[model samples]
Target: MRTSSLTGVTPVLTGSYTPDSGGDGPGIAALRLDPTTGHLSYDEVEPLPVSGASFLAAHPSLAVVYSTNETEAGTVSAVTRADDGTLSPLGDPMSSGGANPCHLTVHPGGEWLLTANYGSDTAPGTVAVHRLGADGGLLEPTDLVVHQGSGPVAGRQEGSHAHQVLVDPAGRFVLATDLGADAVFTYRLDTRTGTLERVAVNPMRAGSGPRHLAFSPDGDLVFSADELSSTVTCHRYDAATGVLTALSSVPATTAEDVANQPGGIVASPCGRFVWVTNRGADTVAAFRLAGNTLEPLGEVPAGGAWPRGLALVDGHLLVANQHSGSLAVLRVLDDGSLAQPHPPISAPSVVCALAL
Candidate 1:
């Protein structure tokens, strides 16, 4: 694997998911990072007419970016990236086929885009797929797979709420995490047709509410961050067969309280450590791999409240704090511990950050 060199790393993009009812936040914020000093400076902000521009994904090999307009009537939009790291609207937004589309990912081959719709009163949670034109514009959805079933939890798990959809590293399978169902559903991706076919369902502990998942560098292991239970579960992944077998589940926070909610999870670039964010606890937990198992190293304060997303860029760990509406940059030490080089930078309703 090629490691990122920190010498020239500069621009970072952030996505805000503020609801129209509340805060005044620009949809996208541009930031410049000083690689030598690990300091961040705000550059500019772009206003997206859409109410909730929540999550953002970059094209695999293009100067394009895609964002999920997370609202009651969900939509997805694309933007063109300029040479100086500015973005311009690509075209009109496209329907996501369901309400409150929360997460989206670009296929590794760059031919397809997939979104996980967190359904509302009038719709059911579904996974939608759209074909990408050569210019990176999103076409109409080719397929929508609506999920059924619920978990044991009340209120939160009243119905299926698909939160995230990610294509496996090998591009052979797509995994969708259903927070309301407490399951990770696997699908066989038909790349030629931009469709999804369910192959397997890996159920988590009842009320676990699995949200986001990360695959190990070798693609043999998968880790899921359970939002409701504040635990991280390990699964053995068969890349060829598209099967996930649960191995173990561990708490993300050391606190005895059950109120901590986990948000995003990621594996270290070197695959030596796994990290997860705890919302109520306002901490990021570090766990080391021990032969398919995770051993907790410790947890550090996330520098603000509600760390929703995490990204590793230029030897730094960037965290998007939602409630606090700030971006925290921390130096990632060799031992996998985080050290703050500067105070958190301000950005309203910051939920997702992408390093470019």
Candidate 2:
């Protein structure tokens, strides 16, 4: 059964670091999206308590959602999502097995949860695995693997920083992006044991600082958002052997004299284009896909500052602006360019947007 709604209104959940955790917004918020005009507003002003809910992922087999507690002593929590889009705690939080966990994903089987702990400046990052119970609650820990490496970039690359983790579209491999190490790790997860086995360490440009990656619709190619160098790397993925081979790198924006850092990336559903968010440039850049080349289509103002994450809702692109504290809605034109449908709506310290 589905929750009744006002015509075509869509529900979206937002994750943020509360003022208690050095950010704006209260906590996890439920937002109403009017797709007809790309208008977004708060369904309610109040929030459900989940401290530092920096990132969120939905369960594949249940009405549950998981979030990373992005604190010094990292933790993960699960919540039961009502059909009306309200959220409630499902269970007590579980240790993430490392510090500052930033991203998480549910395995295709819906039996395991994986998290990437982006350790602080001195500590190395780690990837932790936890089993999932029948009712969608988190079970005991299975395995934790620590990453070790450093990139050419100073300060930001002094130690390993695992930025994002996800299962490949093929469901045969696990990929984690390490920003401090300038490498993307490939792993084979033991479904029965909930353990991870290292498969390959795909290296990127020395100082690129790979943060997140998105696979092409066909799953044959991948585009990585490099934070430190403000570039996107194209990789050819061999689904049969689970191998990732870097083909090329291109600037996230063509603008000059801008100190840009790209933090988010997504591929069009049609496999015809790729989009990346530039923080310093405060804009979203679109690129046309031709074989392995990423040709610059154009750039559009992000409608705020520090655009950190993006989510697609039908023909609209929703951008989370961390600093300016607003959600920018862009219409995806037929030619792959972006245009603002209307003024951005207010959303304080919004770091991640996940449309339900």
Candidate 3:
């Protein structure tokens, strides 16, 4: 087990894109988050020796962190965190059953680890459900639900590419966003049997290409960051029936001619605001909650280039500026707007931030 020099400061784990994934990065690293200033401390680890760990998720009630290897022969691995801030592999890596596994989430019950395999041209994107060990290790997969279909968009929409997989707040359904298919599929997980039952396939705009989704604080709605169209769409979620109905849509960034690809999205805990990161525009746009709809609250420079991932913690927003290889910090304002961004912290190909 390797440990970073984290003593007085609280640490936040970060995932990065490595050379294997066409990125120049140090794989996985540890950074610090200051509760008072809402700024990040420029402390990185002797980076964990993992490859293509482009995204990461922590177990809800455990000290284990999970990562998708995100390679041609996709794999998943688990690492346990020690009390002294050391992290060790829980077990040997296991095949993800498809290529380019991009996103994953631990079931609320903590019994399963789910992955969204964003397959390449030869492989179809699939959702794989793996049984979780008592210690949060990834075990054998119980199901691999492959997505099928294509959208009107060219190149990116040529095949089925599942980008993100998340379990609903209710813990009754698992929703996977397929950007290539322009659809969001809802599935009911049979915990005892370790299976996924396809419940609903909600279609987005013909070529919206939804990437990641965030639930409203109230859990009554889901906000999707549409990558191809650069729009944010609101969907009314029916928790009872596991159905999602598209309600409205708004441009992720009103900035004209930017050709932006909307990436990460986050909703305020108070339900007062929602923020979406625009890559090409290099901005983070805000939306004010007006009754059941959203009103544009303007945007702020993302503080770095290619802001691809975001995390909102304690009134502060952290943007993973992928192309620029840095992490930018933005303060969340009371009126649901963003203040000027703070200085960017260097981190090679930083793609995602997970609170530790």
What would the per-residue lDDT of candidate 2 be over residues 55-158, giving only the tens digit for each residue? 99988878888999988989999988776566789889999999999999999999999999999976789999999999999999999999999988878998
Q: Which regions of candidate 1 fall more than 4 Å away from where they truly are? A: 1-7, 19-22, 44-50
lDDT of 3 by residue, 1-356 (tens): 22335544457778888888778887778777775687787553367767888789888788899998989999998988776566678999899879999999999888899999999997988999999988888888999999998999989999999999998887889999999999999999999978999989998899999999999877899999999999998889999887889888888998886789999999999877899999999999999877667799999999899998899866789899998998988999889899888898998889998877
TM-score of every model versus the real structure:
0.94, 0.97, 0.96
Give the residue spans of candidate 2 off by over 4 A: 1-7
Candidate 3 Cα outliers beyond 4 Å, as residue runs: 1-9, 42-45
How does residue 221 of candidate 2 score in lDDT?
95
lDDT tens digits, residues 1-356, model 1?
A: 11122446577778886657244568877777776778888765454444577888989888888998888878888987676556688888999989998899999988899999999755678999999999999987899999887988878888999999998888889999999988889998898888889999888889999999999988989999999888899899999878888899889899775479999898986788898888989888888988878899888888799899988778887888899988888778888877753689988888888877
Error of 1 at 65 (Å): 0.4
> Which candidate model has the greater lDDT, 1 or 2?
2
lDDT per model vs. reference? 0.84, 0.89, 0.87
CA RMSD for every model?
2.5, 1.5, 2.3
